[model samples]
Target: MARTHTPRSHLSVLHTSASRFASSPAFYVPQTLSESGDVASWKPISYIQFLHDVELFARHWAHVLKLDGIPRRSVIGMWLSGMTYVDVLHIYGLSRAGYIPQLFSIRLPNPDVVYELLSRANACALLVDPSFEGLLKSCPIPTHRAATTVYDIDSHDMPLPSLPTLRERDTVFIFHTSGSTSGIPKLVPCSSSWLDSAITKSHQIAMPSGRTKRNQDVTVWMGSMCHIAQTFMLLGSLQHGACTVQPSRQAFSSNELSLMIRDCGVNRLNQFATFLAQHLRNSRQNPRLLALLQTLDDALYSGLALPREEEEWAHGNGIRLRNLFGSTECGAMLLSTRGPEMFLQPLDGMSYAFVPVASQSEAGTSQGGHSAPLLELVILAESPDCPDNSLRAADGHFHTGDLFQEIRTGCYLSKGRDDDWIKSENSLRCDTKAIEDNIRATCCDLVAECVVVGNGRPSPALFIETNSDLPQPKLKREVLRRTRQFHSRRYLHERIASADMIVIVEKGSLPRTATKGNVRRRVTEEAFRTVLDKIYGTEWTGTT
Candidate 1:
């Protein structure tokens, strides 16, 4: 029998390959309990079967909603968690049906924000998780019922159908920015072609071989499904015919994660740095992690900043940690495999370029200013024609709001956000990340996480979390000394003199969204109101 291969287009060649794989039993590895005490064993499905299921769900959705011949640009909202295979299938199905899937993160703070984002994005239908249906129903958005229709994916009991042909340039999914601490979540449309390009580029760059072979590697989904980085990793794995091991929605302990790592022989682990840091703290140096690391070929870290200590720890454990720099708007742009060497490399194959801001204009200042310190990303800027104009540039480069500095050869260190940098009394500017890094270097053993916030106030406040056993007075004194040591070299002693350390609640006390550590809201609500007032004997109220 002659094998059929779908033609690649601007939409997505990787998705087509994945669909083809799902049809045959050659790629099928049924779910089985491993000898190791892991919760769920790796279940590999045939690419053909996967495509068939996707087509069935697509047909069912189209028939139920009476949406016939809807154009490729039609938007469908997907409210799902990362744990289910259906989430990935739903995205592929939407692509097959020539519809753009708008994936909503389960970690979004509330339903109102979700509704607002959906309405703003002009979603035509919502494929919701049954568990979250109740919350969606309560959204106050009146026009939601009229403009958008709802489809319960969990409620469906249809059989798998034949797959449909899809174009590569057709948008497969839409990822919204996590508006946890920043502005409202904006839609970032991703074409099937983009996914294919990303996968091809990443594979070429990483050059996996031997046990790092496509089929043998185990990819774990650590971050939220809503995060683009994790989605990209998932798609990349599916394309390479790798086994994916994802944890359940229920609380996952570090011990359980270690078990899963060992049971699955997970070679490739992709996740947020914060999650890995937490895992490193919670899990002891067990045989499982050690065994997994022995066989581990590569690991990728992103989302939050990867601290030096954590990176060093991973390297010490014989794991190659690739620090990746990417955004929801522009897929995966940068991969730092050889640590800082990645920054010195040229912009090759869908990469990022730092555009120095020439001068500060009214419009530029409004949009975080284009100063020497601020590097405007020239790749994947929003279309100027669009009303919202979320994207900054159009010449294939987008102006990333993140601030960075070329510290030395091959190393470009990230400073704090342009908005978060605080100006001291002597007109000296202090980057919060720099301050946080200093604190971490000094109190690495005691502090789990730290966030520096300079609200519209005279001095920046350092919110530190220490070990429960550490005496408050000693910890405060140590923190002050560290802060002084950091500022002394910069000759900003008087400027930072007013800076104060506020001992926030213990680790895990702060609130967090799916992709971001939202310290602003948490500090204001929890630390300022409850703890700081009691400790300092003053009500510290400031807008963050």
Candidate 2:
């Protein structure tokens, strides 16, 4: 059957870009770096070269599939790390060569979950980095399915074969949820039409005020490509004609990042909020990194929320930090470009609704001490903002588990996930994220990181991770004093009942997701089950 051609086909876009910007540098890879965090040497891959590389990979994979007798358009599961050009190239090349690429994080802790995802995706083959070839043996996949590493293909300048036509609804790429909340990742297939619409919207969406990255700006992605954010951002950069730089290492130190910024003339930084916070913390001692950050056009972050203190520090230091808001199921829909408070605005032409959540109170007291309405963001399925039909609910809208607080008529600030709400024994519910944010904002100096528990208990308990040498009692007193001051107006069920509920944990010891380092709330709660039990003295024994 003939497949309908979509205008947003990435292969077509790459062809157009290669012709339009043949000599333009598509990516800059760090070749060498000095001990003093100086870029000693680097290599730039031109757009023409990039297209040629894509074709080269496509041809190599095509020949491999021919030898293995795997049919075209078969789903191929990829487990590549290193965050190098190889990962990006493999994804693009597979799509161009008429195969669906299913991306998997190398950091997925369970081999069973990986096998299950692969099985669910009906993956006919596996492509992996050499380092991860052991995964093939670890998973009990069918022996008939072919498995190949990056080095298995021998490249030659054979003429590229005709690419297969892909239908609008055909799956081009497959992504997965963060699985931090769900405990197991869910597959999210990116359709051709959906991706096309996403790319088109990317061009229409306005960058945050005073924080836009120009087409000629140098951008660097600081996370795994397995993440849909990085992959989609790369496409957006391509559409915008921005030159991206791939760091020498998958995981680089703050000093190494500074060197990349210095040597690569990097104008935009795209990283997780946690890493950005870490850089800010490191910048306290290393003024050079801070200076380099101040010089950047914009620091784009997503994944987790940046700590309140670190966010303020960035703004005070003259760094423009923009937050990209979206998810694997829905793609990017919102961007925070206005100011340090990180209020999000929807993309141009994207229709969304902030349905007010039924809270116990008439209105919740927000961080600004104003009675703000709490709403859950919903993307109307009929709107252009809707990515795919996979996650659309029976109501015909994609209900993002994300909750936002209305700052104004159109602007909204993230208040964390809907599941982040804690229901007490009395049936009163409070936002765990809101309480934690308040405590962190007020007790920034006393608490490095914290989590609030007691989902079905009488009251919430606090867990703190701090670097201060103060005694546990004094630290609890100080934290409680500040938190109480911040939560004086908040409902009693929303506040920690007493100082005994504040448990001090070791710094950097919170359980976090492997990909973005977001603290797994449920996992963290489970880790301190005994301590929480002791604090509560008794379980509510009610359905959470």
Q: Pick the candidate with the highest lDDT.
A: 2
- List ranges where model 1 is wrong by over 4 Å: 1-42, 67-73, 138-171, 180-183, 191-196, 205-215, 249-252, 282-284, 339-347, 357-376, 380-390, 393-397, 407-411, 421-544
**Model 1, span 1-544: residue lDDT tens:** 9964443432254446555555433122225444443455555566666655566556555544443334446676777774556665556555555566778766553566677677877776666666676666554322121111123442155443334455544555678654322224566766555555556555543445465434455666655566566666655665555666656432355665665566656666666555555455443466565555546676666654554565566667666667666666665555564543334232255545665556332122211233234455445433211111345445444566655554444345454344554432211234566667777888787677777654322345567667646687777766676666445433221123432445546677665555566555334445455454454343332222
TM-score of 1: 0.62
Highest TM-score model number: 2
Instruction: Give each model a TM-score.
Output: 0.62, 0.73
Model 2: lDDT equals 0.71
- Tens digits of per-residue lDDT for model 2, 321-375: 8887877777678888557667888887778999988763335566678978778
- Which ranges of candidate 2 are over 4 A from the true structure? 1-5, 33-40, 138-153, 156-158, 180-183, 204-215, 249-251, 360-363, 385-387, 420-544
